[model samples]
Target: MNRFYDIINKIENNNNEITVSEYFHRCIAQAINENEKELVDWFCKIKNDVEGELVAWAEKHGQKYILGRNRAERKTWGIQVLLGKKIKYKDTVLNIYFPTEFHENSIIVEQCF
Candidate 1:
């Protein structure tokens, strides 16, 4: 299986806070190294879609949290997706913190591996 898929599968299996972030960061790093342009573009698009979905969901549910400007910027051919939350990347793991407070959310990050 692709590395990204494997990471996502691991995240789904664990469903823990730290694990999710680690998996996401590792997957994003791999995606950045493998196909910089495509991953960057796709991340930019997906980030926007996710923000919109989160906003609509929050509005319907009367949530007070804000959906800030989520953007994916490229730096030296590396793609970084900046949400309101912060993500830390290491050699072996990627850490992500979910913005929602109610339920666990799953993100399907697709890219060529």
Candidate 2:
């Protein structure tokens, strides 16, 4: 099994809900095979505490909108939908929520879609 899958399995087996940060950390630790400190720093820089932001955005935007990154390269790490609501990209009126910003070398956002 791939390392990412392994971390998912472990989390599932634990039967305890974990934060998104925890999940990201576990996946990065297991899969990257690189400098741990660097990877962790990168992860911390880009990952957002999305739950609260999602809720607030949804409430304000009527729960129908797209959430994406402003940076072109980091687009994938941005979410396209939340709670089954399709995010509308390029819609100036629709509100969008992005993950935390990071310095250029600290993190790379993978496209989510």
Give the winner by TM-score.
Answer: 1
Which residue pairs show backbone clashes in model 2?
65-87, 66-87, 66-88, 76-110, 76-111, 76-112, 77-110
For all candidates, the clash counts are 6, 7
Q: What is the C-alpha lDDT profile of model 1 across 1-113, one tens digit per residue?
A: 23434333332322122222333354556567667555445445545654555466446645445344222332232233333333432221112222233423434332211
Instruction: Point out where model 2 deviates above 4 Å.
Output: 1-26, 31-35, 49-53, 62-82, 85-113
lDDT, each prediction: 0.38, 0.36
Largest lDDT belongs to which candidate?
1
lDDT of 2 by residue, 5-103 (tens): 333343331222233344455656644554555545544444453434544555666644323322111123332222331233332221223333454
Off by over 4 Å in 1: 1-15, 18-27, 66-113
Please give the lDDT score at residue 79 for candidate 2.
25
What's model 2's lDDT at 58? 51
lDDT accuracy of residue 112 in candidate 2: 29
